[model samples]
Structures are given as structure tokens and as C-alpha cells.
Target: METAEFPAATSATDGWEPTLAAALLGAERAPPAPPGPLADLVAEADPGAALLARLAAEGALHRAGTGLGPEALAPTEPRDAFGPECPPAAATRLYGLLSEGYSARGRVEEWFALAAASGVRPPAWLFQALMLHRDSLPATAPAVVGAELDWLARACGEAPAREAAADGAEAADWAEGSVAERRAAFAAFRARDPEGARAALEPVFRKEKADIREALVHALATGLSPADEPFLEACLDDRAGGVRLAAQHLLPNLAGSRYAARMAARARAALTIESKRRLLGGTTHSLVVTLPEESPELARDGVEVNTWERRGGGARASLLRSILGRAPLEAFAEHPPRLWIELALRSEWADPVFHGLFSAAKRTLDPAWSEAMADITAEAYEGKVTGVRRTNEVLGMWAEALDLLPDAAWEARVGALIRARKIEVVLAVLAQGPEHFSEPFTATLLDWLAFVTRGSDALRRDLAKPWVIARLGDRLFPSEDAAAAAAAILARLPEEDTDRLRTQLTGLTGVLDLRAAIRRDFRSETTTGGMAQG
Candidate 1:
């Protein structure tokens, strides 16, 4: 074996190279000699150990000696830079909020919106941090921070040449890009031109990887229409099982499409409404469903042949229920929604029938059916209906249906859920409902939240506190009475006890105070058309 020779020394500090190399290889293989100024310090020291110390001291000198002079900053157009820097206090608060964690995402969005509306940029020192953690920010963050990000990108020589050219590159990249990028590009294209987006994707639909194809097909959900039906229907026979399932999920949304029409016809044929005379006096309507055997058309429309085998027993009956769920609501046009609810409740396939009607209502955007389903769900949740358990499953199903109702209709239900100590259900309902709660609703909810927090046990209060604070900060805290609300909440704190609950209340108070300051600063900036130094 040959010993490798070092490259020629290129600088005055190169004398230390062999000692460093010898230290790396260990003294057993290569002994080191005292080098330069270290000779006086370690002249009598063991050769190997001396060399290691010398390497450390000399490395420090080398770094200190090689510092480069500052380079000139590239020029940026005045128009390209953001209008003004954020107020110093607001910027400091943003840093504190971000340092906390992702729990602050909603608060950060609020700050970003305020900054963007106030025509101010974040502090320059914070740009790199924000860019590094950009993924933590919401999708809408980019638009809010667009000018600042664009300015930084240009400064770092990472900006695209032109917006139009960037878009073209994006379109081209989508063909060969990763799954997420492809989905994003496909969505963007669909939003602009749904038909064109579908046409562009069809040629390569079969050739793409299975997961990628699934994602790209799923993106059609946004601007879905009859125009995209042919492509979706063809995907039902795709080689990828996930692709077929994705197509199945999306096909139901198109209520008037052929796929829906076929499913509706099947449902109408299977279910017959009949009037039965009671023993005492009144007549009652009942639903009699004749289960249809599995067929090619049924399979193509998303009825699974093996579902019964998988779940064990009642295969044909379950398949019939599935078909009815996906079928168009117009198929039952002759019957009132309440009758359908009653029939589903009376039948053996109650869960499937109930879920199917909810799906149909959501797909059709039928307000009347949505309200009826919400009422049934509420009754089930309250244990007012016999034979129905108020389990998480029931609450979950109710939340799903409740989400589709108008805010005004769901508002009272929210109050009732809170009174019932069903905070999770309330959160789920609000999560799926409109983004902004009305003033009256907010006031009512806040009063209930205060009542719950004051009266409930520690565990229950803890469960509800975060959501209450989050909602207050995200929505209601911006209202004119926010200060009053905060003060009222603070005053409600139990006077005798000081613990985690008090700390939480105090923290919420701080957030409210900070938000009030931010609002004032934002108002000043808006009136003056520049960042206000508050």
C-alpha cells in the first residue's frame, strides 16, 4: 500500500496541514512534530497529543485570518420592495408568537393579514426565519407576504424571471413533478379552465404512477362538472385501485351526471313506499326495499360486490343501501324528507340510509333536507329517539349533517350542544360551518363558554378552554366589544384559587391585549397609508 501525499501548500497557514492530517489518522500510524508558535508551548509534550492541541489553536487562527470583506448588495427597484416595515411592537409580538409553536398559526395568520392590510413588511431580520419555516404558514400566507417574499427572492437571486414565465414553468413541471406539485398545478389549472385542465391531464392519465394519478384525479374535485365526468367514469376501470376509488368518491358530487342518474334509477326501482293501516286508527307509510343482485352496471356505479364478505353477511342488502346513498336526492321527489327519515329509522339499514340521505342532501345543496337531517341528528344526539345510542358515531354523523346547514339554522344547535356538555360536538360543528360567527351568535357562545368554564370540573374546563380561547382570538376577539369580553372573562376568574386555570385565563388576557394593540396600530397605518411606529 502506498501512503497518500498531501497537495502543495497554497497559503502561509498551510504548515499546519500535516499535523492536522496526522492527528486525524491517529499517532499509531503517523507521529506529529511541534509546528510554528506551538513549539515553545509543547516542546516537551508527547508528540501526538501536542499535535492535536496545535491543530485546534492553529485552526482558530486560520478562521480568524480568512474573513472576507463584505460584498455590495444587489440593487432592488423601489417599487418592488414592500411599502413599509411593520411596527416595532407588532414585529416583536410576531417573533414571540412564532417562537411559541404551530398552535399560533391562526394568530400568525391574523397578524399577517393585519400587516398586509396595513401595507407594511415584516422586519428584515425575520424574513430568513419566515422563509425557512414557510411550510408552517398557511397557503394564504404567501399572498399576504407576497411582496416581502418576492423582494427577498430577488435579493437572493432565487426569484423567477416573470410571473407568466413562472406559471409556464409550473405547467411544464407538473408533468414530471412530485405528487404534491402535480396536485397543486392541476388545481391551479382547473380553477382557471376546468375543461382545459381535464383535457390536458387525460392523455397522460393512464401512464402516470398510481399515487400520482390518484392525486391528479382528486384535484378535479374543486371545479368538477359534467365536462369532467367522462374522464372520471373512465377512471373507474383504471389499473390502480386507488384511482378507481377516487373516481367513485367524486362521481357522487355531480348530481345530474349519467352516473348519478343511473344510481338514482336503481334506488327508485329498489325502494317502494306503501301505506299500512294501523290496528287502532291512523295510517303509516313504510319503506319496502327489494335488494337487487350485484350486476355490472351496479359495480361500475361504485357498488362493491365483496363488501358484504369483508364486513361479514348481508352483502346484497348493504350494496343496495350504498347505491341509494349515492343516488340523487331528486329520485325521492314524491316523498317529503321527513318520510324518508322515518322510513330509514324504521328499516334494518338505518345507518346506511341515514348517511346516504345526508350525502345526497350535501351533494344537491338542498336546504330543506339538510335541516330535516340536522333535526334527526339533534334528536338522536339528545337521546330523544328510541333505539339509537348517543355514541361518538352518532355525534359524528350529526356533526357531518349539521355542517351542511345554514349558520342561522345551526346557531341554536351549537348552544344546545354546549349546554349538554358536548363540547367536542360543538367544536366539530363550528369547524365545518361558516368561517365567521355572527355577533349575536358569538355573544351567545361566549356567555355559554364563560358559564361552562366557571361551573365545570378542572378536566372538563381544561378540555374546553383552549378551543374557547382559540375561537375568541380567531373570530370574536376582533369585534368592537373584544376588550369588554376579555375583561369580563378575567373578572370571572375564581378569586380563591390560583393555578393552571388562572394562568390560562391570564395568558388569554395577554393575547387579547396584544391583539387590541395590533388593531390600533393597524388602524393608524390604514389612515396614514404607511406603517405606524407604535
Candidate 2:
């Protein structure tokens, strides 16, 4: 065939294919002839090296001749835009703050709030970084970030258009959107009008995929009402286990709902309290459990009978615990909570009964019962109570109950526990304690820390010291006396132990200093009405 009649390679890169093939197969086996302009370029060059040199020269020429093709038309500006661009100084400060290894990530919300309050939007290039880290931002962030993201989505299509559907036209879009979009739509609908959201989902309930149906059912938890119960009850028999479990979890929160009442009835039937009076002393109570031979009704209510053998008791005990856990706390009104607790503590079914009561206390959030449970837990932790196991599980349950107690009550208990050197109880209290402590409670805690660090080698080595130090940093370092507290802690550090702890103590001091500086800068900026120069 004539050379022109043969197919012309598209570019220098494609033209090198034959030479590369010959080199791989060995030139002696399959020598390649340079084609087209490459033949003239390599005519005087060494044959073995000529092909590669020609390919390189031709590639360079092609690249040099190429120019950026005509630019595509720019995207239209979004009709909706974010507020004013973020202040350049403030943006710089934000970049610096985020780049550092700061332990207090919660402070990012404060920054976002300040930005929003100032009516400033972050730079466009920073939007992707912000989006990736958005979970740390407060829920209110979207009010500020949403418009900016919408602008970004329109310009570059990087983000999903999650703005609430406008008017009625977008409802069709919502139904046809991806799972995340549908969830967002359902949430927005629930917020605006819960009954309407439920109505919208009902028609599509059976038609939705199993996972989607489960998610939609869970959405009922927001703004739940008697109106949602009928639909939820029907969902108890959903083909998906997750959907059924979601229904089971949501029903108990409706204290007076029929589902709760049914659970209460089952619990009462399983166990009865009988009071007995001693001849010379006070009245005592005993529990008489009458487990059902079979309880399909309870099973339908979400009680799972244990198929596996248990050390304490078999399926009967599991059923009792499940029934008691789901039963309304009000169902035990015949006897005071304290009376029931006393009976539960002394009864043969202590573990299951306490488990159920703890569950009930958590669900109801009854202050009195929560306090009583906390005391019971403290007594158990201190080894003052009989038949109460002191495992981590029991301690955890106690801590959970204490979380429901009033802040004042919990703080007081923590102080007393710390003073008594009940390290385990103190740790438990601190683990579940509120983020911010009252001034007096903080002082008491600092005093405990000072005492612990200075007391004994053994005390310093106790695991509680490190736990206290790590957990109390946020609470302590923000106080006005942070520097003084840090000094006190440093002074108490044993001279012999100081070497091992210097790094940790230095970090703590550095954090305190940084927080102090941040506070001062924030105040200065607020007063001056000007951004702090980075």
C-alpha cells in the first residue's frame, strides 16, 4: 500500500507505537521503519536511538503548537447567593486555628457563629474543606453555609441541592431523589408539618425498598404523636427486622400509648410484690414471680426470649427483664420506687429486676428514681450492698442513671466521692458529668486534684489521677484561675515523678495559655469592632 493510503497515526504519541513494539520484540526480530515526518527527522541519527529521539522531538513540537482550546462558557451565577464574603483577616485566623492540633474542637462552632453573626461567607476554595469538616459545625451553620453551598452547587456542581423543596412542585423531585435526599425531605416535612410528612410516607410505605422503609419508619421518631402510632403499630410486623426494631424503640417513648400500657400489664403479671411484717420490727417485702408459660403477646411487643442458656436463669429471666424494661415506670405506682428498689435488691431476681429498673429510670427520666438509683449504685460500688455485683457493667448502669439525676445532685455526689477517696465512684461521676461544672464544684475538684498529686506515691500512681487530669482540662483551663491551678498542679507533681510527667503537664499548661489568649483576643475584637490581625 502507498504510505499516504496507510492509516495516519493521530499524534506523535500514537506514531511511536510501532517503534515501541519493535524495541520490545527486538529490532533484529522485527525492525521498524520510521513513518511520515519521523523518517526525515531520524535520517542521519543512529538507527537504534533515532526512533526515540524523533518521537521526543515530534512530541515537543506537537505540544508547543497546541494551545488551550476555546474556553467553555462560564456557569450562570446562582440566583440565590450567600451573605457577604468572610472577612479576610477572620478567614486567615480560622485557617490557622483549624490547622493547629487544638483539643477543643467544640470551639469551631463559636467561630462559625461569629462568622454568621458578622454576615460573612467563607472563601470559595475553602468550601470543600468546610464541607468535609461540616459535622463539627453546629446545626445552625447551614443557615449560613447553605446559601454558599447552593451557590457552589450551581457553579461547580460539587454539592447536592438540599435546600427545602420550594412550594409544591418540588415534591415530585423529592420522591424521585436519592435516599439521602428523600430523608432530608422527610425531615424538613416533619419539622414543618409532622402529620403531613406521615401522610406522605404512608402511601409509599409498602412500595419503598426495605432499607428505605426502615429509614422512613425511624423518621417517625421526630415529632412523634398518637397520630403516628397507628402506622407504627402496623410497622411492628414489617418484613425488615430493622423496621420492626425501630418501631419497638419509638413506641416506649410514648408513655401513655397502648403499646406502653400493654408492656406494663405484662410486667405486672410476671412479678407481684407481697408485704410482710416482722413481729418486733419494720415491714418487709418479698417478690413472687409468675412467669408466663408462653407469651406471644409479649413477644409481639418486642420481648426476645433467650434461646441461649444463661448463668443466672434461662429464658424466663430474660423475658422478665425485657418486660420490666419496656413497662412504664408509672406501672409500679402501687409501691413507691424506693420500696420496689428495696424489694428488687433483696429478691432472688436482683440482676434482672435492677436491670429493668435502671432501664425504666433512664426512659422516664424521673429525678427521684434517678437519685435513688445513683445511691444504690454508689452503695454497690462501695461494697456496702449485698447481692449487688460490682462489675464494670453495673458501674456503667449506675453512671447512666446518675446522668438522669439533677446536675446539683450529681455534682454534690462527685464532691463527696472525691473527698472520700472513692476513686472508682469519682471516675464514674466525672465520666458522666456535665461539660461545665459550677464554680464551687470546680474549686472542689481542683482541691481534690491538688490533694491527690501531693499525697502519696501510690496516690499519684492511681489510675484516677490521669483520668481526672485528662477529663478536667476543659473545665479547669477555662476558669479565671487557670494559671494558678496549673501552678498548683505543677508544684504538687512529685520531684521524682516530674520527669515522666513533664510533657503532659507542659501540654496542659500550653492549652490553658492558648485558651486565655483566645479569650482576650475575642474580647478585644468584640470591643474594637475590628478583626484581630493574623
Candidate 3:
């Protein structure tokens, strides 16, 4: 073979392929037309030179990718498979999930679970593309793609090489790789040894530009702890606002960090809970809100004060709440979380005050505070609380907190909303996501759906019903059961109303039907429990 220089030529990274036979045969036997971008540049060239140019074009085809991209360093034969590709129906659905039905991203997981249960693999035509895009799929995707993927996995350089690279070798990639690569390497280092990652990062840390520095600092969150406090506290003084913000996020989760300690002290000093003897007899408690004095120094702790970057709330109020939000839940050791919950409902700064506790509870996973806030938020929604005005914003705060509650608490709060027909509040339980829904959690959801899909007050009237249904599709278990429920509900609707509502609930009923079809089409002899029953 011969080569030529064609630096000006280009190839479509995805669409182009080599015409190897013409290139290898030489200009005597088979003259080749110039290919890809070379078409215009080499069109007038004599055949031999054109073939040589095609050979040179090969160099540009080599690409830079995650070690997961497909390549082959040696001659090899395709592996033998134990079973055929998934059923035609299953393959068609997988293609849809990856393409058109991409909006319902949650269903991707269900697709894989069904594939795994069916003991089938992706068809050959889609195999290479699936291998290339495996990162976007569930971790189980490779296994679902089956043992046939072993050679491709090796071709991508992801065997021992990928494993070995994840260790100390990763730190060196900081200088050699792209920002995505650097972040991945730094994350690997952090995962392996956070302290060591910090040490390795600190020496070279300031050398990069601000945006890159911010991303590298974000990698510290992998195994965050008080050990990261000093480093992150130092980062709060960074010139980039994003760097300071990233540091602020990691610090709150480390309650023992100096940042947390300083914030807790400032919060206690600002809002003291005072107990006074009542003139009649008993004692009463009141929250004395002495807001903090804001200044430029507050920026060192990620609290914006005098700068143009000060938050929406006034400097003093913002400072107080920022401190309260990051403060450890134990900061107010004297008062039970429930006491603050009730006080917050009646307090003049209800949302602002409770928001701090809610933030702290979520960051720390303090179940006590989460449960209490959820109860009050639901009570306020039920119209049982007279003094406080129940607004969507208030409901939003507790809806988010509901996800953090213990399983029993999560069930109780959601069940309460379902019984009261507070569809809005019930739907708001997806602050984090609709993932992790246990059987009981999904059972509560099904009951709510059964109630709201009937009558004129049905979910059909809610503008967001379809969007909510799509988001909840993967969380609802046992598709056959959900499908049965959905079909029964549709059957119960008046003939005229039935078709219209079904059109609106395409997200709910459609997903259930699709899942049931997948289950039936891909049913395997060895299929067992997990999602197989669905």
C-alpha cells in the first residue's frame, strides 16, 4: 500500500466508511473516485494518486473516545452466541425507547429488566450502535446485550486497561485529557482515595482556568468529608462564583466541617428560641429572629453579602437563612424538630424559616425533621391549619421533603393527600424523582390514579396529568397489574368520555400497554421474579 498527504480533506465521523477493495487494488485494476471531503479536493487527480489519498484518509478515521468506543487491534473471529436476538417485538420497542420514545427515559430501565428476564440480546444490526451508546443505558445494559459483547468490550480498551487506568494512573490524565476526561480521572482518584486525590489535585489545581477548576473541585464530592472542608473552605475564596457555589454545596453535607460549624453558630446567634413564663401560668416559646449583619467577609463562607451577586432576599434575611440552611440539624439541640415545625407555620417568616430547616433536613437526611415538616405541610394542605395560607410554594417545600421521609412516613403523607383528593400535592411527591418506588409506594399511586380517573373531577381536567403520568410510568410496578387497572378504569368511563380520557392518559395507559406487550412478547422459560411478573 502507498500513502499521500491530504491534510485538507475530511470525513464524516459517523456516516463515512472505507472502500477498501478499490484502495487496495491500485489504480491499474480498479480506479477509485475520491471519497468523502476528498471528493471535491481529489476529483481531478489521476487514479493512483487518488487511491494513495484514500489510504491516507484512513488516519483521520481514528478517533478519540472513552475507552468504550469500538476498535480492534488484532485479527479475530466473531463469538458464537447461546441464543438468538430478542423477539422482533422486543427489538422494535428497544429501538423506539432509544429513538422516538426517548422522552419517556424511565421506560429505558423497564426495557432492560424485561430483556434480562427474557434471556435475549440485542439484534446484530443494532449491536454496534448499542455498544457505542452503552453509557446512556442502565449499568445492566452490557449484561443484557449479552456475552457477545465481550470482544467489543475488549476492542473498546475497557478490560484490564480500563480497570488499571481507574487507579493512580488516572491522576496523570489531568494533563493529557479533555475536560470530560479530566473530570472522570479526578473522580476516579477521589473515589479511590479522597485525601490522596486532594493532595494530587492541590499541587496542580490552580494552574487551570476558572471553569475547569470549578469542575475539578466538583469531583471532590465523591467521598466528601470534614477532611475536604479546609480545601473546600479555601475554595470559597475562589475568583469564580461557580467554584464558590460548588464548594458551598459540598460543605453543607459535611456537618462537622468548619463551614457548617461557623454557619450553625451564626444561625443560633441570629435566631434564638426564647422560653418565657406566661402571665397566667405556663411557659410559652417564641423565636427571636435577629437577622445577621451581612458584609463582604460572608463571601468566604459562600454567603453573598455586599457584592452584586447577593441573593434575591435582602442581605440580612438572606444571610440568616443561608446560615440556618447550612447549619447542622443539632444546632438547635434544645428544641425538638416538631417544635420548630409548628412555630414555622405560625411564624411571620414561615416559608423563609421553614425553608432553612427543610434544606438542612434534606442535606443531612435528618428523618426527624423530614417527618415533622411533611406532617405540617400535609396538614396545611388539608385546610386544618387556619393561620397559615397554604400556597403551592409551601406545598412544594413539603412535597420535596416527603421523598426524604422514612418509608412509613412517605406512605402516610401520600395516602393522606390521596384520601383528601389533593391531587396536586400527591403529584408533587417527585422532587428527587419517581425512582425507588416500593410496592407500597406504587400501590398508593395506583389507588390515587383509580380515584382521579373517574368522574368529571377526573385527572382529565388536570393540564399536567399526562406529564405526571409519563414521569410515574417506570415507578408503577407489575405492568400486567397496572395495565389491568388502567383497562378497567377505561372500561368504566362513559363511552364518549372513555376515548377522550384514554387519549389524554396516553402516558399512563400507553406505557402500561407497551410494557405488557413487551412482557408477553419476550416471556422466557427461565424468567423469575423481579420485574418479570410485570
Top candidate (lDDT): 1
lDDT of 1 by residue, 1-534 (tens): 346565543334344566577676766565444333444455536666666666775566555654321122225656455467766777777777788788777778778878766677777788777766666876556666665666666776675324544666455556767888788877878888888888889887888899999999899997988888889989999888888889999998886888888888888888878988999999878778777887877777678867446577777767776887789888988888877876776577776677667767877778788888888877877787666778877777788888887777777777677777766677667656656667777677667656756764764465444454544455554554665676687787777644555665666566666666666655445475665433
**Residue pairs in steric clash, candidate 3?**
none
Model 3 worst lDDT run, 10 consecutive residues:
64-73
| Better by lDDT, candidate 3 or 1 | 1
**TM per candidate:** 0.69, 0.71, 0.73
Please provide, for model 2 over 81-154, each residue's C-alpha lDDT reduced to its tens digit, 9 standing for 90 to 100. Answer: 55666655556556666665244465555566666666666677677666666556566667777776666665
What shift in Å separates residue 524 of candidate 2 from its native position after superposition?
Answer: 1.9
The lDDT, on a scale of 0 to 1, for candidate 2 is 0.68
Cα displacement (angstroms), candidate 2, residue 76, comes to 14
lDDT of 1: 0.71
- Residues 1-534, candidate 3: write the lDDT tens digits: 565332332332321233355555557665444444434445436778766665554434434322221232235556677566786667777777777545746667777877777677877777676665555777667667745565566655566223444454644566557777788777877777888889888887788888788889888889887788878888988888889989988888886777777887887887777789989999888777887776666667777564542545466766776787888988888898877777777787665578777778878787688778777877776567657677877677667767777766676666666778776766676534445566666666676776777646445556245356654555566556777776666666555554445664556667667766767767533445423322
List lDDT for all candidates, in order. Answer: 0.71, 0.68, 0.68
Prediction RMSDs, each to the true structure:
11.0, 10.9, 10.9
Ranking by lDDT: 1, 2, 3
**Candidate 1, number of clashes:** 0
Deviation (Å) of 325 in candidate 1:
2.5
Off-target runs (Cα >4 Å) in candidate 1 are: 1-76, 79-86, 117-136, 142-144, 160-165, 168-171, 207-212, 276-283, 305-311, 379-399, 415-436, 452-534
